[model samples]
Target: MTHASKTTTKLAEEYATPIFDHLTGHDDALYIPLLNHAQSQGDVSPVINLVRNEENFPYAIAHPLTGIICLLAVAESAYWVPIDRIAHSESCSSCAPIWRDLKNRVRTLKPGETFYAAATTHSPMGETRILIDAEDLEN
Candidate 1:
């Protein structure tokens, strides 16, 4: 894992603000059940594997934007998943509707739009940051 670079942090704040606001504004009660469900099923290895192997994940981009979205969502909600767990589990189907919903919303970002994401290790000693521009999606 690596820390968020300056560029990544700036772009992430710019792009993720609206999305995070939208998610947080909703009735949080609706997400409690799903959060609880994900908590109970603690195994997230599969999702981690996919994140590490971007080629295996269809939505791969220059940045781990999806993981960042997942991190933000979990942070704002009652989702018990840790940041590290959620970062890797962005593609985890068993997680909940919120993860998928966030991913879908992120996918809708228009061309030229850009964002940054940082996946930090549990120790907080390191993190990996990615800068995702819409153009990266074209490849």
Candidate 2:
């Protein structure tokens, strides 16, 4: 299996926090299937490619799934954008929290430490969490 698929399956099977439960809620039914489809058909890359081709693509950065995907793309060094676009954009309001969270994660990284993007989970109410695995950086 691909790394994304392994990560998706791990998240689907291993984690069960209340936050995850709440975020998933009803959409839990669709999350795994969509994740599988994205992995199988490589849908994630097209979304990231759009971001690469157009940094200011209207709602691309603000929609939860796409936003988290963009964040993970950046995290994995697959996409690049100016710091201003990530931090100061009113156009990406829905993604503001993610930007802030990314900054926070970076701030906590120790010397010789690195991180890897794992997966994104889309909630029923249109929220997203970009999973990162600092422990799996070597992989």
Candidate 3:
């Protein structure tokens, strides 16, 4: 490979290790489960989720009048399916109540909200996901 191309590849590899990719999942498991995983892993950086709707994670922007502006995106999907096996085997109907709760609670989450845990990964329905037994998590 050319020197420039090699450099670019190396940079990509270096950066890709930290990036987490998630799939179209039911409910906002990204915030609940993923967030919990990152926290357990001692990830100090904001959960950089790279799937559900592209967004910048904890990237700051400078402002002339103000000091600075920081933006964060919660990588949460808006879909929750029933647990009925007749349709989807990966149904989350058992967590229907939680989904309803999140439906209301998530709206109150601001982009600049402070948080302790956040995670992102490319796991399909069959793959294992980090889970926490906490009843509620508030930022």
TM-scores, all candidates, are 0.23, 0.27, 0.21
- Candidate 1 lDDT for residue 12: 47
Give all candidates' CA lDDT scores.
0.33, 0.32, 0.27
At residue 9, candidate 2 shows an lDDT of 58
Clash pairs of candidate 2? none
How many steric clashes does model 2 contain? 0
Ranking by TM-score: 2, 1, 3
In terms of TM-score, how similar is model 1 to the real structure?
Answer: 0.23
Model 3: ten consecutive residues of lowest lDDT = 79-88
Residue 59, model 2: Cα distance from true site in angstroms: 18
Question: What tens digits encode model 3's per-residue C-alpha lDDT throughout 1-139?
Answer: 3222432445433422222221223223323322322233553222223222236233222211221221222333311111110011123454344334433443555654432222332233222222211221310
- lDDT of model 3 at residue 7? 29
lDDT of 1 by residue, 1-139 (tens): 1223422545645654554444334333213222222233553222221122234321222234333443312222112122322322333234354455444544665654323223343211123333233332433
Model number with the top lDDT: 1
Clashes of each: 3, 0, 3
